[model samples]
Target: MARVARTCLRSILKIVNSTLGLVGIAMILYGFWMLRVLQRDMESPSFDDFDSTALWFIYTFLSIGVALCLITCLGHISADSSNGICLSCYMVIIFLLLLLETLVAADILLNSDWEKDLPEDPTGRFHDFREFVESNFDFFKWIAMFIILVQGFSILLAMTLRALGPNNGSNYDIDEEYTSATLPLINPHSQTPPYVVGEPRFSIKNDAWNANK
Candidate 1:
């Protein structure tokens, strides 16, 4: 019974960790896609343009961080002793990455001066693109912000669930560990109950004693 319980737990942990890892990867990909759009604007050159290569590097770093998180999750699922350390390190790294991304994205949205210093002018095409994004960037910024928030929340929940153990069932009961009255008797034909203690019924040497009594 204990073995089966552990096996089921292992399987659940594996699934949870693996799923979270894949989600992290997906988030990184999403970031890459957004960056591509921003890059496209930069290539044509915009006043609000950013360094596409630098942004690509940031996404690459985030991708690496996500990979680290996946390794930590794998350790947890495998029940390795080092899992705790790995998880702690990756948690901090993930949080920092989120913060970094948020700051960079905010700068891209709120600080036009910072954009002015960027190298989006291979041929001064960036000035034209800036005028275009200046009008539509707000909507895109809100959407990107929402996605980042949701992704972060998902990571937090996954971490909490992983720490608490497997999420097999929503409800758990300690009473189920004990045999209850509702359970069927194992040997109905036995006059003596399994858990009850009573006087000895008979002994070969006490046959005469019983008869006399």
Candidate 2:
């Protein structure tokens, strides 16, 4: 049971963590890359009027990257150590993150005038970000969907890992969890009370003869 559970849950968790790490690194790199674009555009004079508000997007990207890196680290620690404290903290953070993203995603998809709910952007950086999303709707949409799936999977894995508790150094241990446990016989009156364990192994000659009779 432990081996099977690990094969399904722990292995999937590893994949999710790796995916998160890659996404995080990509975001971090993309943030830097955007900064480069900003610098170049500013220098090119064609974008001299670049709204400083664009910094908002850059900062948000970097912030998300940092957050994801933190999550990935927490996930790794929780999965490897299976410490109660670590797992607890990881679950709380992941759940909060999922909630936040869910809310934002819901707003974006459900609200027709989502932009109106946003604060007025004097620097127009928000407008630019909105425009970017609108222009690359398909790509961003898929990425967001993927992220949601990954987060959901992570939550399930955490719960399952918690239920399973720390591995006892062997997968078969789970299957034998109750092997030595005292079990009551179904026919308690017919069998002796101490017959909780399986009946003593013995020749069944008497039973065979009885069956023949």
What's the distance in Å from true for residue 123, model 2? 7.4
Q: TM-scores of the models, in the given order?
A: 0.38, 0.66
**TM-score of model 1 relative to the true fold?**
0.38
What's the distance in Å from true for residue 40, model 1? 14
Task: Please report, in order, the local distance difference test score of every candidate based on alpha carbons.
Answer: 0.55, 0.77
Worst lDDT run of 10 residues, candidate 2, spans 178-187
Tell me the spans in candidate 1 whose CA falls farther than 4 Å from its real position. Answer: 1-82, 120-139, 165-213
Best by TM-score: 2
* Residue pairs in candidate 2 whose N, alpha carbon or C atoms collide under 3 angstroms: none
> Model 2, 86-192: lDDT tens per residue?
77788888889889988987897799898777555444445676788899999998998898888888888888888788777575655566543434434456556
In the range 113-145, model 1's lDDT, one tens digit per residue, is 886656434433355445756789898668656
Q: List the residue pairs that clash in candidate 1.
A: 45-125, 45-126, 46-126, 47-126
How many residue pairs clash in model 2?
0
* Model 1 score (lDDT): 0.55
